[model samples]
Target chain A: MIRFDDVHKSFGPKKVLRGMTLEVPKGESMVIIGGSGTGKSVALKCVLGLIRPDSGTITVEGGEGRDRDAFLARFGMLFQGGALFDSLPVWQNVAFRLLRGSLKRPRDEAKAIAVEKLRRVGLKPDVADLFPAELSGGMQKRVGLARAICADPEIIFFDEPTTGLDPIMAGVINELIREIVTEMGATAMTITHDMTSVRAIADRVAMLHDGVIQWTGPVGQMDTSGDPYLDQFIHGRAEGPIEAVR
Target chain B: MTGVLTGILGGIGATVLGLLAMIGRVTIFLGQTLSHMVRPPFYPREFGSALLTIGWLSLPVVGLTAIFTGGALALQIYAGGSRFDAEAVVPQIVAIGMVRELGPVLVGLMIAARVTSSIAAEIATMKVTEQIDALVTLSTHPMKYLTVPRVLAALITVPVLVGVGDVIGILGGYQVATGQLGFNPAAYLKNTIDFLEPLDVISSLVKGAVFGVIAALMGCYSGMNSGRGAQGVGRATKSAVEAAAVMILAANFLLTGVFFSL
Candidate 1:
């Protein structure tokens, strides 16, 4: 589980996260949804310690600063843009953390792990040797997903996991994320504006607005939920209390 | 008058703050890079690429610059010596000049032009494309994974470039003296060899190392601090080259002073 308590973050004069707080339990999928610039990504980044909050206490479930390294060790991430290294082959990119760090396995074993992860993400073993530029957008996204889960981490963060995909491919990725999260019994936190991805992958949903979590509940309650912010966001309506532009 | 004075004070404060931010960023980058350097499974391919960029590719330019500089230096020294009816001093002075100052400084400047711009452009492009963030999500530290290997390669390889440049520069002097200036080849070579001291060679190599570090440091610093758009990348590349060139020249002057105080 991950917890944020009164987190405040600002970039110069723009305050992105304003006293935001939330909790995500272990062994569940929590998808954060919001309009662009509503701080969904910022919230996720703070949990990963990528961006520190000005004033807040963040911790893994039942653990504190002492468990930082251990906590970091138990997580993986898939960024919105498939950030593949142009300089490395697909297999090497997937196996980067496994083969090139203080925690290294043998090259062959690392390759096998990368191949296996690729397979799980519905890619051929042959594709592992190709560079990212040679792969299609969908294939690259799959590769990114494979690389994220390659470490077999207990907590996974997916930032807009299916934004750029067609519906069919998005559905495939959504199924894969669900399958993997359940298989590892890992806590999964995903941030996205895509509602189709929400339906397919989320066990629970949270909506961020004006730097606060405006609503959060089981996915079943999302449609009938009374919050005007939730209604405006889910229906993709423009003229609500939530302004279209910041 | 008071308002103008206050405005000047505010300008100074803003400059101080900007410098502080830049300093803070560099410190963080170096700390992370060192951490990655020590705790790596190590990427041999990346290290080799860095070596090729900082060392091998830099050689031709350094060599070209050095050779021409040596020829021009020889002519200038000869012309000055002729004013005293002592043109014979050209060979000795050319060798010492190439070994002690021009060899390292010119090679360093050449590398600053080539390697700094390349690094800054490559890294800025990576940032723009989200590749660097991908490294982070993949559990790879970008500083260790990207910056450290390049920095270490520069530190280790640029001195070799300077050494090679020194030989080529002295050869250039020989070419001009024997083929163009009507001096005997054998006598010019002998004078050059006899005039060289080990201290001169050591100082030249030391300058190479310092210049290499400065070049790489500027690239990484500017790249990481780059803004979010196309214009941002351009600015980063421009600043990286300018800073690298300035720092290299400054370091050369300081090194020369340290090696030979008045």
Candidate 2:
């Protein structure tokens, strides 16, 4: 389980996360939905230790931050952009952690593992030999997904997993994400504004606004959540309390 | 007034402390990188690319610069020596000078300009684009995976660049002596070869190794510490080149003193 308790983080005078608290349990898929710049990504980064909060305790399984490497080992992350190494082939990128030691076997063995992971994400074995630049947006995301699960991390964090793809490709990626979460029995925390992805992949959904979680419940109840902010968000209405840019 | 002065002093002290802390972190990271290199998970592709950079790709420019410099040195030595009725010593002096000093220094600067800038720009761009963060997410440490290979490659290959530079420099002097200065080609060749000793070649190669370390370290350190935005990357590349060049020259002087103090 992951828990953030009264987390208060600010960048100078601009408070990004204020008294934020949430918990995600084992084998659960939680998606945090919010408009742009509402600190959704910052929340994920805080969990990953990319940024530290000024005041509050972030604990995993009722334990304080300890054994960072051990903790990090259980976490897999898919960044907003598919940040693959341009110089390496797709196979090396996917099998990176697997080949880190005397477990660093021969090229064939590493490639085989990479191909298996790729196939799991619905990618062809031929794609493993190509560079990331040669792949399309959806294909790269598939490769990114394959790489994230290569180590079979216990907890996975995905940032905007369906932002740039076409509706059809997005649906495919959503299905793949759902299937993988089920296949590995892994807990997932995904942050996206795409309600379609939330509907397809989320077991429970949370809405973040004004630097705090406004509401959270099962995906089936989000439409009738009746909370002003959640209603304003899901219906894409700019009038109620959400301010317009103008 | 006193309180303001104290605050300013405290700020300066904090800045110094920050720099010292950074140095400590870099030292720890360096040790980790060295350890990782000897263990498993070596990337031959990264090493080969760096070798092509710090050694082979840099050769043509180092050669061109050294040859022209050697030719010019021969002419200048001939002109300067004639005043003392010592023009005959040009071949020997040019050979020793090129091997002992200019070859290593020029090649060091060349590698600093070409390799350091390129490395700094590449790494800074990576930092800005979250590629380093991506590596971490992939369960790979950026220092161990990205930095160690390039540094190890530079350490091994730059001495070879220096050795080649030394030879090309000598040939340049030979051309001037045989073609322009009307010296006996065989005699000039004999003087050039016979006047040099083992220590000269060793010192040149040693300088190459030290300069290589300074160049790669400066590049990697500045790049890793680069700030946000494209402007930050531009500054990092500039800083890396300047730091590498200055450090190389400083190292050259120290190595020269140590090598020749006998």
Candidate 3:
């Protein structure tokens, strides 16, 4: 449902995305894998218009020409860090979209939805009133996830959904994401380098290197892709086509 | 020696260019903030909170600064005027000075030190944490939600604070004059009231409004453009206060010239 066409983005002398082109089919979880600083985040940001691509077009079901608010209404994002509004309590963060603007609902209704979403993300209802700072890292990520899915968006973007969590918590998050995407039938785009998370959450896998998608196929095909960069990355080998250091 | 001179000239040129570029960016930010302010989806809740933080919470500091400065100004005027046997002129001078200059300027500077720094640091931290991007992804405009409310609150409230400061400052002068300087309380109050023209009060309020806008805008601009991490936040806060203080003083001078010249 989302398409990136010849996206090229540069920051001064550093060219982050050079001709990155990818398509995410509707109702499928597409996980983008890349090493550090390979512009994975930038690519997702381009789709959201958070970072304008220097020369390219990103269209979400031909919604690029729509009103900015309308265009953004179709999607939700969970940042690398939870990115929860620290000033707000957990429930407020989840209900943020519902409490303001075009999607506004009554305060009670919004709070109910927030509680339900929090529950769906494996959080207790009692955690709703607590502030984000009171939550642990894994709990914070769950809260972030709850916020992302609270609006029932048509598409969801997860940026490193399991970065700082323990292995079991990461697995839990990956499973939750997988179940949510399947149950909601939402198009999902997640960017991460975690092989475990990829195996758990992705229907399709795309390996990014040197600002371009070097290999892409079904998650089952990832192991035998034979592309040096993908093989090196998935294997976590220090010696390969992908350099250990910049 | 020749190379060093060329290097110095290059450095000076770069500094001027940087300053001009900064001014240009801030001007653009101000325009965007104004445009957002006039648009729909007004955030009254955020504005109300901002009014409390910027206006109500600021009263104590503004009052303290004004009262102390007024008393100090009275002492200095008494000392200086005594040289020419003009100690009796303290009430008139203090009233004029507090109403026209010190009230607005000192309050503005205090806000720069307190409110401006806090705003910059908070927004910068939000930026670093990616909450700003989250706001965008939620179909909310950061300028409308964050900048406009604070700026509008400052615009509405700082003038009122300046008026309060002017009165408290005059009262402080009266206290010092009547109690310690051995002037009659009624006469001191009368001279102070008579010396302040309506125009002087208006000028003071106008200066307050301008200084408020400067303080709030500088804080928001530095914050929204801050780099990454704790150091970026610290730098943004420092620069915001510096810019606001300098701008308030400079605007004070220009405003004083404008009001008096007319």
Best by DockQ: 3
lDDT of 2 at B157: 82
RMSD of each: 2.5, 3.9, 1.0
Q: Which structure among the candidates has the greatest lDDT?
A: 3
What C-alpha lDDT does candidate 2 achieve relative to the native structure? 0.85
lDDT of each: 0.85, 0.85, 0.93
Candidate 3 clashes between residue pairs 3 or more apart in a chain or in different chains = none
Q: Write the per-residue lDDT of candidate 3 for residues A1-246, one digit (tens) a residue.
A: 988889999999999999988899999999999999999999999999899999988878857564888788889899999999998999999999999989999999999999999999999999999999999999999999999999999999999999999999999999999999999999999999999999999999998889988988999999988889989889999998777874
Q: What is the lDDT of residue B187 in candidate 3?
A: 89
- Lowest lDDT 10-mer window, candidate 3 chain A? A62-71
Name the runs in model 2 displaced over 4 angstroms. Answer: A11-14, A61-70, A102-105, B1-45, B197-199, B257-262
Cα lDDT tens digits for candidate 1, A151-183: 888789999998888989898988999999899
Candidate 3 regions off by >4 Å?
none
* Residue B7 miss distance in model 3 (angstroms): 1.0
Docking class of 1: acceptable
Give the Cα error of residue B167 in candidate 1, in Å.
Answer: 0.9
Local accuracy of candidate 1 as per-residue lDDT tens digits, B103-200: 88888888878888888888887898777766665556678767888888989898999999999988988888888889998889988888888888
Cα deviation of A65, candidate 2, in Å: 9.2
Worst 10 residues of 3 chain B by lDDT: B189-198
